[model samples]
Target: MDYSKDKLSSFLEVNYSALPMCCIQKAEVYMLDEPSSYLDVKQRLRAASLIRDMISSTTYVIVVEHDLAVLDYSSDFICCLYGVPGVYGVVTLPSGVREGFNMFLDGFIRTENMRFREDKLSFKVSEQIDEVVKRTGNFKYPSMTKTLYHSNSTMLAGFLKPDEEVEMPATTVSYKPQKISPKYESIVRHMLHEKIPNMYTYPHFKSDVMNPLMIDQLMDRKVQTLSGGELQRVALVLCLGKTASVYLVDEPSTYLVSEQRLHAAKVIKRFIMHAKKTAFVVEHDFIMATYLADRVIVFDGEPSVEATARRLL
Candidate 1:
């Protein structure tokens, strides 16, 4: 138990001290149901590690975890289960780790020729994760004397780019707009050198943000002369270029076409997870928000007025 706790500490994002309490006897077979439940991405990995630590050739450890990343990292073999809840369940014979994960995601049993789901689900995590662990994290919010309006407003996120003019939402005005560039690459270069000097290299940024948002095709276009959709894409590229603990974005889908709106949601979701950062967004697009958010805070009162913040978990 002591070894388990110590080995898990490196991957644990949250403090967990219940390892000893959860187990009283040493058994040949141990089972845990959704141990990754209630844990963030980092903690989930640690939980997976702890479960793996419980295994010996003589002992079999089974973890019923829903998180694909945790499951993939934790198990050497898997039993994919398909069934109607509380009625009947079909569990396949154990398969090698990668093969089991591929089958689970594909939602098919090749041996039985069974298709549990009509649609296949696919997703990827990229290289943006390297920087998340390097930073210290704890949100420090402001304390103010006067009441502040909730409707779209601007704030100097005191930590990012020193005094860089951030044109917030709900405002028709622009502050400190930089020189228009005929080539989009110039704008990115200027922003990189002037603002986040140590930002990930251009190639890395392109892999994490540009390719998904399709910013590369606009590389030669002038910033001021770009169309609404193109400009939105540029803005997204710039916003996601820098690294931070908390990202505040307002109405990201503005001026974007239908397809671009969906792509923007994907960009936000991928960046948040890969970077392991928190994001607060002010968006009127309900569909986009629901698709991107894991937990959403609902305004339980009048719009642009008094409202209680309720979380839909």
Candidate 2:
């Protein structure tokens, strides 16, 4: 840890500087927002451990995070915030971590008798018996368990389960990066019909992507007035509308509700398959990725510094 190292990204530098303050300063309360944003899986676990170790009997920590595993590891109690984005939000009373997560996933709070979402999200279980046997032919067992602990406290253990861009080549390529800051003042219809590149020539884009993602409903709304989820859907249509041999979709699940995400995944998957075109999707959602991808590539190391990707076989 050389804090002055030029190779460190802004995210890493911020973590290095801010985490020490949270640990050392005598503050009555500490707050962290998405501290695990750019960190890889291994680094996230280490950061969670550090946060857990820094807690004391006198201090209060309120963390705004989306990663369930990290939140589970780092929190004693969990408070779920639910509501329409850019609209009113309600926070539930603090409950045990497991219970809070269950309530969040189930889309209903039992004690308060409230339902935020229309559908519950459930994981699809898949077993690879041949792959499992092939990987574990020998008598030796692999590390299949995870342990969470504090420096001076008893350990808790559990058994668990489990973006990009660029150009080039013979055929043209189009990219939709993970984030889009809505700076436009034009309406969605204008943006769709004339604003985006090749919008006029994009055949059946509205039928293929827009209507499915429900972008037609927002056609009259200004781009700047659209919510995050609405903007994301518009972006997807823009990306898919372009005439190119290959399409790069980064984090298509961002800011989208569960139902919208599933629909987006379906639209993208169908478009690619039907058109017989090539698409590289960078997604964080398990169900979204599995549904859309034929083969998966795993990335390792730092995000922007010295990253590497290997395709799963």
Candidate 3:
């Protein structure tokens, strides 16, 4: 099924607020029985009840809020609460663990916890948590405390070091364009249908310098040459000509109206899916990115691109 259809199916099946409150509380696990079709209120309630039941059966329940943009301490705590085996070591303190659950709600804590796990295989929230536990007199519960170490010098030293240069392998890095095979020609033709001015004559001008009707009109004596947006579209068409395992495009919506930009994005995505080639596009427009990309990346001035890619995925 198409992306929109899949998303709508999921949305309908998991729409908790739409379902009856009682059903949501009693359900175990929800599955998309017929993902291709739309679901009514009754179907949604049944799905929610199944999911609720599954969650209730487990010792530790984790509820991930859909609107949560960042996973924080609460998310990590929930994950750890569920992930660890045996109920003996795990502790669920009284509701008054902190002054408010705000500290545990920020995603930064979750990110830091992940970093701690990667570096030390253990995560300890601040000593304040222990203080809070003592204040509330929940000390009888077996609690797990994690200690995090902070070293300014070590952090600065890593930042000061020069970034390692990536060397392109000699065999794969070539300056010349590889010839397009006849089998791949069909894919190219299909992609060109939307970008090309006249679909009828696209086959005749695949490799020729002859511009499309729009390009010709722009270059006419009465009108000025093509604008930046027009040039970018031409650049995009040229980029698609190369043969590669993956295509990395950065911000194709530089100068275009909303509708036009969306149209361009759809065309590019179709090409990628049709060719069965991986496409990595970096975009700041959230709406367009959500519609066009399979995954999104949010950069935070970090040295590693993988860090951002992981969060997006």
Candidate 4:
């Protein structure tokens, strides 16, 4: 039951300045379910490091985690568990971490000759997200001046600090804010016209946004009367339908289910690439962010106050 300040901080959201710790005298095997659920990237790494250091020849640690990177860094073995929760689940025989992760990602354990999921999960690194930032450097977005910085200090767009003054190029732009307001009865289609004119006629949008978001099912509902998830989908489509050099979408996965979030990320990425446009997305859902981003930005500072851009990694 014992954990250090840094370790506890990784697991908790509260301030850690004068934190306390409680120690356990004796224990052996330990288990953690979704250990990295609440942590940011930095905190997740720290937690993984602490757990990694705790492992011994006699100590067997079983961590039930969803984040691939954190699991890869901490665990020595991998056991893929599938099937519906509160119903039935089957755990694969333990395998090496890499092999297990690969099996989990591939949706088939080759050694066991078993296939679980029909839909495979593939990971895309954040380099494409960085490339979006890099693409923005070709022109100047003088009004889009704020830098999304990191703790150690790296700029995503500009080569230098504000004093150094490197210009960013973005001739055309479209942005979807974190908060949105409803304006019409058929809010979904109405937003499309208001924010992304001709969205219904936008090529591939039906497949990319309309189909995945089930916009057809939602088109009849009033915008203000729509559910959170419905509204989010409409907002996302609005952001993607517009023709622009760069798209800045804030918190696209909010009020969505896990599966919907995944679909949203893929849709966002596909539309951006299809249109040959750049996008900067600010997302809180870690899994969706990792899947959608080409470059992940890390901001370090006070959480709400003085929360400044720190770096792009």
Candidate 5:
């Protein structure tokens, strides 16, 4: 629960004394500096840190944001609150947690009345457990209920409730854009000095700006301005420019628009196919997967690897 600066202040004014002081340690309560504007990237980074803290700490942390009502009780269920696009549900899992915990997620898909059979170590739903098993493929370990919700009723039913649609405020600003520093410039210059001619130098070369050439120039000009896509592009350049034997990219196309995403795919394909380097990319884009990969590993029901040459024909 990462609260914006304004929301935190208001919350403190209203419930500072009322809040359980015994629970929250003085060192744990961090009030970040107010961002310059909503577009500040540092704010997201700061919020990420706070989120990490909350997840790691034993204390129950509550984050208050503008446009959100302060609940009386702490919620066990995590709600996204913000209606970020392409998300299936509000309380799926936090990013950091997902990255760490996804490996342990054997039977944790969305479901209700699910039971774990330790003898066979399989997941079983009351009604359609068998069907789900067929669809997901048989599991080696017992399937545990993905969602753990409590009901006051006598029957303890484990069901996944539809997430409430939360309308985020029009201007619940999260980040403020940062100014490029000398360190950013030096990084870009070092990249340009790599002697890659096709790598077009941009204006603001810093990872923050949208335009590629401008981003490079900005890196030189000490002006850091960029969107998410631009930052990914800059990162891609830096990664490819290096002389690594094995390159691994994990979902590089996240938070990108259609055209830019396609362009990024093309760039990645070009790099992997033509460049004298070995690269492994984990991407959801089917087209890019088919085009770029010599041997495609499809993890649908079971992980299957096939040669692209055989599959195409």
Candidate 6:
């Protein structure tokens, strides 16, 4: 195989790079930093298995991950890192996976008896979840079966509850896939101009979403030069700028920090409400998911193997 001639996809690039470390030239201790960054749900599951397989009596693996789902699946013992950014930092003693996550979310460390922040972050429950549900239309639903036939395989997705349907009808969609062109080189200002509803077009969105995302600050910079987080913000604005009946946004929280995630969620929610548009988002961040989802469609079963989608109310 000519490595130089063949252009590998992002998934292949990630797996191929890690293959050398785990398969060919083995190292005593393997370190993976955010291996799930650009991967989809199925890919993250496969990666978790791959990372787990690298562990043995003689070999050790250490991973730094932000996606709680991937972190939970990939880790045995969990360590929490806390501190002011770009300053002194502290690492907590390894704890059980659940405990570590709780500590992080609660902003309180039980073992250390430390409180990092005054407030606790948690998923929205009964009342809070209800407030986010918007009524876009009144539609009828009945138990119906539709099969899409292909030569190789069949796929199914349950979009509504068994008793209900037509809540969200099929329509024209604006989809933002997980993979983006990392090599696209153009000034941010020029790049954004190429998208629909340029910066000059929507003054309100400029203040509401773009400003919070720091897009104004990045206007002079080049797309290829922007950091991952910056690029994500840019991509989001571009996706939202387009007019569509249904917006399919994949992994909007990728490369964003906690604050950025929340901000992005707000932007999406506000856009949906103001434009009277529907958005179907694929996200691993529970906070973002809780904030954006009115109803959930869960994909169950094995990743990259077989799965079933069931509607969760």
TM-score of model 1 relative to the true fold?
A: 0.42
Instruction: Report clashes for each candidate as comma-separated counts.
Output: 0, 0, 12, 18, 32, 1
TM-score ranking, high to low: 2, 6, 4, 1, 3, 5
Error of 5 at 271 (Å): 2.3
Task: Please write out the lDDT profile of model 4 over residues 1-313, one tens digit for every residue.
Answer: 3545455432234322121111122458676655554345576677778678667887767776666667788878888888753369898899998888778778887977778878877656654334553634332222123332221121233333443354445266666665566767555556566666777766577887789777888766678887666778888887677777777786776566455667788889888887777788876456778788776555555532233443555
TM-score of each: 0.42, 0.66, 0.33, 0.54, 0.31, 0.63
Root-mean-square deviation (CA) per prediction: 18.4, 11.0, 24.8, 8.2, 22.3, 7.5
When summed lDDT is taken over every stretch of 10 residues in candidate 5, the lowest stretch is: 148-157
Against the reference, the lDDT scores of all candidates come to: 0.56, 0.66, 0.36, 0.63, 0.35, 0.68
Tell me the spans in candidate 1 whose CA falls farther than 4 Å from its real position: 1-193, 196-200, 300-307
Worst 10 residues of 6 by lDDT: 147-156
lDDT of candidate 5? 0.35
TM-score of 3: 0.33
In the range 1-313, model 3's lDDT, one tens digit per residue, is: 2234344333333343333333345434432222111222234244434434444344343443211111122222333222221123332332332311332333123333422111221122223323221223221111111200111111222222212332222221101111111222233234444344463245433323224213333232211233445545544564554555655554555444333455556666766666566565645444456567654334332211111112433
Over 4 Å off in model 5, which ranges? 1-224, 300-313
Candidate 2 per-residue C-alpha lDDT over 1-313 given as tens digits, one digit per residue, 9 for 90 to 100? 5656565544445554566666677787888876655444566687789888878898788887665667889999998887755558788999998998899889899998888878886644334534222233223111212211110011101112211222113456666765578877888888777746565345576577767787757888999988767888888888888877878776776667555777798889878877778787766555566666665556654433344444343
Instruction: Output the number of the lDDT-best candidate.
Output: 6
Regions more than 4 Å wrong, model 2: 1-24, 125-169, 179-185, 195-233, 253-276, 284-293, 302-304
Residue 45, candidate 5: Cα error in Å is: 29
Put down candidate 6 lDDT per residue, 13-129, tens digits, no spaces. 555455445545568988887777655466678788888888899988888887777789989989888775435788899999999888888989887788997777655433555
**Per-residue lDDT for 1-313 in model 5, tens only?**
3444455432222232223232255655533221111211233344334434454454445443211111112223332322223333234343333431221123232332232211221222224333211233322211122211111000111122223332222221111111112234344444455534334443222222234223433345221444554555555665555444555554555444333444565565556545445555555444334444554433322111111111211
Task: Report the lDDT of model 5 for residue 177.
Answer: 15
Tens-digit lDDT track for model 1 on 102-208?
77768788877888866565443343545334334432222221212122223434322212243333322221111113343354445445654554356666687
Please report the TM-score between candidate 2 and the true structure: 0.66
User: Candidate 1, residue 233: CA error in Å?
Assistant: 1.8
User: lDDT for model 1, on a 0 to 1 scale?
Assistant: 0.56
